[model samples]
Target: MKIIPAQEFEMKRESDYGTPEQNAAVKEIIQAVRREGDAALLRYTEQHDKIKLIAGSLRVQESELQAAYDQVEPSFVNAIRAAAERIRSYHQRQKRNSWMDLQPDGSILGQIIRPLQRVGVYVPGGKAAYPSSVLMNVIPAQVAGVPEIVMVTPPATGGTEGINPYILVAAAEAGVTEMYRVGGAQAIAALAYGTDSIAPVDKICGPGNIYVALAKREVYGAVNIDSIAGPSEIVVLADDTAEPSYVAADLLSQAEHDEMASAVLVTPSRQLAEAVAVEVERQLELLPRRDIARASIDSYGAAVVTASLDEAISIVNRLAPEHLEIMTQDPMEIMGSIENAGAIFLGPYSSEPVGDYFAGPNHIIPTNGTARFSSPVDLDDFIKKSSMIYYSKEALLRDGETIMELARREGFEGHARAIAIRLEQEQASQTGGNDHEL
Candidate 1:
């Protein structure tokens, strides 16, 4: 890992997001799936994932979901159950009811919140099993009262025959029975535009590899999409009082996610920065995914020494990291000044992994600098709202002239005339068909 001064620090976008050529290839895949449907989906699945599948095998069978429980240990089941309840409890609070406000003129205006009839969740597979991904994506949709929650994950991870049992068990625990064995951009295509086996969904959400992320971007308008996620990133803002070992471990947690994943430490104390630099080196030697973490740390990781803790926090906002940890004399004091971050872990004990797994909040967070404008996946992602309006005759009559005047000013004569005609008719009725001024 490099220890660059804060004055010389530069943030670089990771290249793993894919080049133009990769994006073109993904576009071709989405178009092919749209044109060829199941045939193209099967072909791409075989070509990319090295898994040959017939149309009948595209969807996971009910029997397979039942059998997945037998393959996993009891401890795993209990853990998922606990995570599910906590996640559900957290999201249920976000559930909103239809509301209305009655006006003085007997007019009523309201918002009708309706859960999407169907939704698709994409869980990344290939590198490792993300059973937590299943819970994070599906539970919110379920809480939104969505009737059909379809999940898509890559099949044959590392050339294995079946999907990961942990993922299946998590899905089962979350009550997600409708799942697909297909993954990659092709799976996104199937979700965006229906195939013979899989029906199209109203919206798609989840994190995936670059191909999947680009595919989601391609199919966004065809079906609603969550934000285009980039590689994982974490920025730790610590002071001299922070423990170097805990800071080192937190930085490495995001780095191990992928070679493109970035882990940065920002501190005011040169002593703490030097200490964390050493600890990160020591910890990396023991990490199981040392190769990947090393690549990330070599290119993207940094230990920036700012002039002050306030300066470190300012730099963190500029970066708008996906995960931010504030380990200082008072983490809350630093937290109050933070303007941008997807998730914030305060103090020493609140590690990044806590929110990733057991903690109630969704781990599907905004990545890259998207935290500057976007948000983590939550209950709102799964629902749509229809504005409700009830206008009494008196209400429209009182506001009719104002509406016409504004419409006329906007050069919408047709709109103005529409209101004028109604007003004229009302006047004619009131005056025994003699309201000529109207």
Candidate 2:
């Protein structure tokens, strides 16, 4: 890790729009699926995932879902079940009810909050299994009262004949109503456009490779997508009182995620900054994903030294990291000044992984510098709000002229006429006079 002054350190935000070839490939795949439906989906799966399947076999069987239990340990099942309950409970608090406000004029105005009828979650599969990802994406939709939650993963994961057992169990525990064995951009198209085997979804959520991200970007208008997620990031804002070892470990947690992932430390104490730089190098050698971590640390990791704790926080806001850990004498007090961060961890024990796996908060957070403008995945991501207005005759009549003035000012004669016609009829019914003249 390079130790540099705050003025010299610059946080890089890498865009994952993908190469032109990759974009063209994704576009071709999406168009093929749109034109050929299930045939294109099956062909792409065989070509990219090295698995062949018929339309009848696209959807995972109910027996396969139940039998997945026998393939995993009881301990694993218990943990996932516990995690699901916590995730569901946390999101349930965010659930909103449709509301209306009545006025003295007999007018009603409010918002109608309703969950999406159907949602598709794309879970990445192949050499790795992320039961945690399944739980993170599915439970929020379920909490928002989404009736049908569909999950799609590659047919074979970890060299197994079918999807990873852990992922299957997680999906089952999260109350997914449907599961499919399709993957890649093809799966995204099937979810967006629908096929003979998979019904279309109103929205799609989850993480995948460059192809998946591009596919989500391509099909956004047809269906809602969560976000084009970038690499993981963690920024530790520590003081002299912070433990170097703990700081180093927290930084490495994100570094091991991807070669492009960034792990940064912003602090005022020069001694602590040097200590953490050494500790990160020491711990990097021990990680199973050390090669990936090393590349990340070498390329993007940094220790920014500042003149004071306040300056350290200023740097953090500019970075707007995905995850932030405050390990100072007063972490809570410092958090009050933080304007940008997807998730904030206070004190030493509240590690990043605690929120990533067990702690109730969703781990699907805004990455890069996007935390400055966006938010983590929540119940709002699964539900939509429709504005409701019930204008009584009195209410419309009282404001009709004002409405017409504004509409006509905008050069919308049709809009003005729509309000004018109603106003004329209502005023004539009340008084035997033309409302337009009045």
Candidate 3:
């Protein structure tokens, strides 16, 4: 990791991470799958994943899930169940209610909150299986009262075998209604446009490689999406009081995610910055995915030494990192001043991994500086709201003139006429006249 003055470091744009060629390839895959459906999915699976899919084996059955439970360790299953409980408990508080209020004028306006009928969760399953991702994606939708939740993952070894047992067990524990052994852009297409075997979903949520992200983007208008997520990132704003070792470990947690992942440290202490930099180098040698982490640090990682704590905080808010860690003397005091960040981890004990796995907060957060506008995936993502309006004759008369005048000002003559005719009819009726069609 390189240490530089905060003002000297240039902010990197998200486009610097991936090339146009990569995007174009993802687009081609998405378009092919959209046009060809399951056949295209099978071909991609065979070519990319080296797995052959038989017709009936695409969707996992109850029997297969039971067998997965049998295969996985009992402690792992319990851990998944415990994580699901925590996630469900936390999201239950975010549930919204449909409400309405009656007025003296008899006009009624309200919103109806309803869960999505069905949702498809895409879990990446090739090199690593993300059981925690399964819990994060499914539990919130379940808490939102979604009736059907379908999960899709790349088959373990092509389509000949099933998805990872831990993924299956997590899905079952999270209350998923169905599971499909498909992956990549093809799986996204299958979920967006229903195949003979797979059902279309109202929304799709999860993280994946660049191809998967692009596939979700292509299918966005056809179906709802949580967000166009980019590579993972973390920013730690610390002071001299922070432990250098803890800061180094926390930064490396996100760095190992991918070569595009960014891990940044901002501090007022030059000595602390130097200490953290050394710790990062020493710890980098011990990580299992050191090559990926090294590349990420070389390209995107940095230690920014700010002149003051306020300056460090300014840099943090400007970046608006997906994950923000405050490791100062009083993290809570600084937390109130932070305006941007998908998730805020306070104190050394509250590391990024706590939120990623066992913590009640959802790990599927905005990435690539999108925390400036986007938010973490929550129950609201799996629900919709419908506005309701009603008006009685009295209410129409009470506001008729104002409504007609506004409509006329807007050049909506038909709207003006509609209200005008109704008011005129009411007036005529009051006078015992037969001009009902006024």
Candidate 4:
């Protein structure tokens, strides 16, 4: 990590989002999968993942899922089960029910909340497996009452086993009803446009590599996506009281995630800044993924010295980081000032990994400054709401003129007549009753 003045470090866009070539490649992949269906999926699997597969083999079998349990240690299964339990418990609180309200005029208005009939969760496969992702993405949709949960991940390559056994075990533990052996942009397309073997889902939720992120953006309208997630990121808002080693370790946690991942520190103390920089350099040598972490720290990581902690927090809000740690003497005092960030950690005990692995909150947070306006994957993302209305004749009569005047003023005769005809018929029926009285 390098130390820079706050003014110099505030410059935006430290990383490249994507290239035109990548976008073009993604569009081509999406189109191919949509047209060729299962054939295209298999073709891409061989091309990208270095594995050739038949249509029948695209889906993982129930026996494979069961056998996955046997391959992994009992400890691994127990841990995944424990994590899934916590994740499910947290998300169940976010569940919502359909609501209705009735008025004295016999008119009813309400909202009907319904989970998506089907959903797809994409997990990155091959040598690297993240069982945590399976838990983070699947639990919310399940809690929302999704009927069918379909999972897709890349196949293994270079004579390696197909779909890491741990990922399969996690999916099984999460109660996934269906899964596939596929990856990258093609997998997203298969989810958006159904193939002979795989059916199209109402929404797709999960994270993947750059190609996966770009593909999600491409098929957004055809099928809903959780978010256009980018590389991992974290911003530590520290003070002199913050421990240098703790700050350095937390920053490296995200930097090690990918070469494009960013880890930043903003504090008012120059002494603390220098200490953390030294600590980060010393710790980098210990990381097995130090090459990736080194590239990230060299390119995107920074430690800025601000005039005051308030100024530092102001800069944090501008950056709108994905993860923010308030490692100060009193982390809570500064908590209220933070308006952005996908997840906020108060003290040193609430480290970033706590949320990433074991804690109840979803770790699939918004990244790349998207936290300014977007949110993490939650129960709301898996469900849809439809407004319900039942208007009685009396209620319509009471508000008919108000509606007609507004429509007529807008020069929409069709809209005004739709209301006027009904009111006129009711008035005529009332007049006939008066004639009988006379």
Off by over 4 Å in 4: 11-17, 157-159, 433-438
Candidate 4 local lDDT, 1-438, one digit each (tens): 889989888633444446999999999999998888999999998898888897689999999888888789999999999999999999999989999999999999999999999999999853358999999999999999999999998877213677788898999999996999888999999999899999999998888877898899889999999987777899999999999999999999999988878999999999999999999999999999999999999988999999998899999999899999999999999999999999999998889999998989999898878889988889999999999999999999999999989998999988988988888878879876322210
User: What lDDT tens digits, residue by residue, belong to model 3 across residues 278-367?
Assistant: 999999999999999999899999999999999999898989999999999999999999998999999999999999998798999987
Candidate 2 similarity to native, TM-score? 0.97
Return the top candidate by lDDT: 2
* Comparing 2 and 3 on lDDT, the stronger one: 2
Q: What is the C-alpha lDDT of each candidate?
A: 0.89, 0.92, 0.87, 0.89
Return the lDDT, model 3, position 55: 60
User: How well is each residue in 305-397 modelled by candidate 1, as lDDT tens digits?
Assistant: 999887898899999999999999999888899999999999999999999988898888887788899888888899899999999999999
In model 3, where do residues sit more than 4 Å from their true spots? Answer: 16-28, 157-161, 436-438
TM-score of 3: 0.95
RMSD of each: 1.5, 1.6, 1.9, 2.7
Question: Which parts of model 1 have CA positions greater than 4 angstroms off?
Answer: 15-17, 434-438
Q: What ranking of all candidate models by lDDT puts the best one first?
A: 2, 4, 1, 3
lDDT tens readout by residue for model 2, 385-413: 99999999888989999999999999999
Question: How many clashes in candidate 3?
Answer: 2
State the displacement of the C-alpha of residue 148, model 2, in Å, after optimal TM-score superposition.
Answer: 0.5
Worst 10 residues of 1 by lDDT: 156-165
